[model samples]
Target chain A: MKPDAPVLQTSGLSIGYAGTALYEHLELKLFPGTLTCLLGLNGSGKSTLLRTLCRLQPALGGQIELLGKPLQRYSPQALAQTVGVVLTKKHYAGDLTAYDLVALGRHPHTGFFGSLRSSDRALIEQALEAVGMASASSHRLARLSDGERQKIMIAKAIAQQCPIIMLDEPTAFLDVISRIETLMLLRKLAREHQRAILLSTHDVEHAIRTVDTFWMLRRGCRPVCGTPEDLILGGAMASLFEKNGFTFDPLSEHRAIAEHARPVGIEGDPAIAVWVNNALIRTGRKPSPIAPSYPCINCMGKNRFTVGMPNGACKNVSSVSELLTLLHEAESMPAQPILPRYA
Target chain B: MRAGLYPILVVLMLLLFAACLVYGSVFIPFDAVIKILAGKAVERTAWQSIVLQSRLPQAATAVLAGSALAVSGLLLQTFFRNPLAGPSILGISDGANLGVAAVILLAGNPGQYFLGGYWAVIPAAFAGAGGVMALIIYFSAKVRNSVMLLIIGIMIGYLASSAISVLNYYATADRVHSYVMWGMGNFSSISLERLPLFAVCTVVGLAFSVMLIKPLNALLLGETYAANLGVNVRSVRMQILLCTGFLAAVTTAFCGPVSFIGLAVPHVARLLLGSSNHRQLLPVTLLAGACVALLCNLLMVVPGAGTVLPLNAVTPWVGAPIIIYVIASKKHIHYFNEA
Candidate 1:
């Protein structure tokens, strides 16, 4: 649990699939007792990174060291006892109960011919309870929903008693509530169990709130590693999206498509044009007949309300940055604002 | 440790052993038969030899062959992770049949065929069985999944059967009849002379299976997990194939290829034990199979007066239903562990 003790390390690593290189010349270290999240676009190498670290998939180059020794040096059994993986689910051929599947975690602990001891059973039950699946222990896997199935898979990994656990896209198939709950459980595991937990997720908000390290894979090369705050402050958030219509929003940490990006001019008289422009931007359609009765608009700079294009064609205003600055100033006054849905 | 299973097996074996003694063309007195078995002088000479030699060994062969085949079946089913896998599934029995056919028909001299006389069939059948095992082991290693390996085995069996058909086509009429009779399967085909080899192979095969008990228990979690638990998947696989093939070849060589017991007895054993852990399942399967075979041998006896029926005919009646029940039952299906 020491900060310097490495749970998993890759040196000069290159990983690929079916002979095509995904990444090369990569060096990374995952520390114990911390939850790390990998954030990336759809085709980014998050899964490849996790797989290569665990040695599940063959690393195309370099070596993976676990506890200061080469990964392949450990026997499969010994390595399995140290690291537990919750892989994406596929076909599991049986009517095994949740408890029965979880009990399989004890396989690495028991003797080749040994019976399940009391300790093994206790661990299985505890893991079941860890995921809030204690009462549903007897339910067959065939009867469980997607959320419940994810919990069972996680519970099984917990029972394995490994010091390091890694998951790939664990929240991909979950609903919003289940996604939050899964991240919370993982956070608890990182804190209480003192196990290094690494997970890949596309849910940006959950990753920001729950994880200790955000491995941002924005540039599609060697991932940039830092705290969530560092990632946002370093302008890494701005390049997260490459699509033609969208741009990353710093304040909300979201993607948005810009419209009516006209700049306001003729400020003066206590920035009256800025105030009216801010009001128009709020409705996103146009200002609801800018209240002529309001004194805020009394000191108008333009010739009796210089009419501009409603569609934000910028028939008058030059740049959208000016309009955004005005809105930022007005929004700071009193009312707590609501961001747009797409933004 | 169930009170019911062991007693049932014991009683069935005993009743069948008793019935075999009293059964023959002529009515032999029960008291006289018992006295003869105990070394009391019998008044009749021909009947004495028939009871002591023909009937006793036939009954013994039935038990031995049945137990070996059933245990082999259980091991293969578990190894392949398929309910349908058995000795025949891998073409081990077909290879034995081909060996027997080559000796009886295709070979120039009938004496050289079983060569060294009746002693030759064991080595001949073993070599044939060994060939088939090599194919199965090759397939198991190359194929990643259990079901795919199973299909590979089926294809191998088809090739063996086809090879057998060609041999049958070219064989002379008299040799063809012998081959056909061997195909029908009969325990009485094992004479008193070959009993020692049969017993030896069965014991050796059974002993080899004991080494697998630990790996078998680990396998219930599936192969990758089993390997993760330090079980060497390839070595264990090789050992299973050799043991299962040897047991089947010896039985098929000596007793005309007994059927169904291997495929069915394991299910009954699993149902009785209620756990797939091989430590419990293996012994129960061997014992259950022996008892079933012994009982069938007893049934073939017409109770104090009749000729013995072929064991193959009686085994199917006992075996086929259990197999059907295992396959057709949807609720209790379990996939055996494979690495």
Candidate 2:
């Protein structure tokens, strides 16, 4: 019960089903006040591991201790009181109001009739407030969008008042904005509420940017757990999906860039040069400082770019779209002097 | 809204109950019926008999059968997470039918030895329904998918029905005729002497359902989420099966395979309450079921037309439209999705 003690710990754990193990001899820890993301390729046992840790599924050969008690030793009610889980299953929330759904999180805490007491009601409202969904308390779930429903679900978990919280791909069906919002919410809960939060998601970029720790899983390999930077620098992220011919380059932009490009030299403000480099790569041209003989695009420091032609003609464009059009026109007519597409 | 609606439902149920007593084929006056019910003497003793022995018991049967069937339907629908699931849809009533068929057609008149034929048929119906319920529960454990479990229940019902068909095909013509008559369903089948047993059985089944309000509400979130909420999913499923099984069996034993009430009434309650929280939904469904059943009973006697329509015939008129509305407006209902 010490403040600094890890709320959840696993040692020599093996997880799987039907007598086969997906992972074996694994060691993991989740401390209070930190967020951990379980990242893995599909069918790489991310769900199996999470389900096992939550005691939804049994572990193959290891012990999971939550709050200093072995997971198997806790009954379902006791486990519910200690660990709150938000599964990825699409439950029927259509008939429940936002308040009703959040109140369901008090299942283990309520009386047999499930009548909420004064304290329980306050907790439900506070939980809804925490997720910024207090205003939607009386609205039926069918009226809300998927993102709103997801927030309500998180509110349900928060109302559970457990020391540890776990979610399974909570952002899977959410839009980008909601995804970031949910991640930020989880991070905030971990830091401010001092709860140990864990989630499994395929959103690798967001996971790296938001989570405090990563549990990277790959088939036939022991899970590698560490801070995001440590894992990235150690090349564990790269090896996760290496077998599928997918490479994870932390330094490169997440969007795919062309392999073959016409080299161009650029010199300008560093801020403008960065976007100019993006524009050149997107237009199938490589921007480099030393390629002085190639057609050079000069960055003019305020969303302006000057394309210098080999024939000593120059054209300036104000926006990236105009720059792309000018680059395309210039590339299509290399034998002619570059026309000023955008004055 | 619930506060206003519940009182309205109670009043409607009372009106229907009064209407059932006053407007039967005999056409007893409302005042005389009230006087007879209040234990006052009436001029025509036959009028007293008709009011007390006949319409009173019939109305009470309708109330019990309606609530029992409706609550059974609600439990199955919530357990399966399918709006279409109900006692008849899952073949549980057919199991009862097959049981009664075996007892009446095959048992060679156990009524003669048991003082009344129902003494054997009631238990037989429970056994047959319980057998099918056990089969459905077994398959539910084996199959994780609700739709699949539902299909298996239907298949099991078909098997029981085929067995009943064979029994019908070879039985004596008189026995076959009686079995067919029972199959049409009648609320007047239970006499005043037998009403207490029926009431007790239905009440027990309903009590079980009441005890399940919390778990039933949890189940609306689907089994995994319910389990995460510390609900013992396996035990709850078993309890639901037992409760629905007992309710379906008891009603089917006395009323024949009463149609549509079990399948359609929960949706009526849901639509009326505009929510599926079982604490509210279960009681509202019970009251709505009784109201519909009483209304159907009143509609059965065409006000001295001298022809009493069968209960099953009257139920579809009330139950089918609601079901059709539910299907046509499936998106608006937002009950549950197959996925």
Number of the top-ranking candidate, with lDDT as the measure? 2
lDDT of 2 by residue, A1-343 (tens): 7888999999999899977889889889999999999999899888898899888888889789998899989887888788888877887758789998999999988888898999999999999999999999999898888888889989989999999999999999899999999999999999999999999999987888899999999888888999989988898877885776455546444323344567677787778777777776666676666453556777775778887865566888888788778767766775533344322
Lowest lDDT 10-residue stretch of candidate 2 chain A: A334-343
Judged by TM-score, which candidate is best?
2
Q: What is the TM-score of chain A in candidate 2?
A: 0.83
Residue lDDT tens for model 1, B1-339: 456776777677777767766765567889889888998888997777878887778778877888899889988987877788888767899888777777777762443334343665667788788888888788788887888887887787788788888988998877787677667777776667767777888888888887787776556556654554456777888888888998898888887778888988888887786556576678888888887877777666555555666667788898889888877874564433210
Q: Which stretches of candidate 1 lie over 4 Å from their true place?
A: A1-3, A17-19, A37-51, A89-103, A117-156, A168-183, A200-209, A214-220, A226-343, B1-52, B108-117, B191-193, B217-221, B299-305, B332-339
Which candidate has the highest DockQ of all? 2
Provide the overall lDDT of each model, using Cα atoms, as 2-decimal numbers.
0.73, 0.86
**lDDT score, candidate 2, position A131:** 96
Scored on chain A only, each candidate's TM-score is 0.74, 0.83
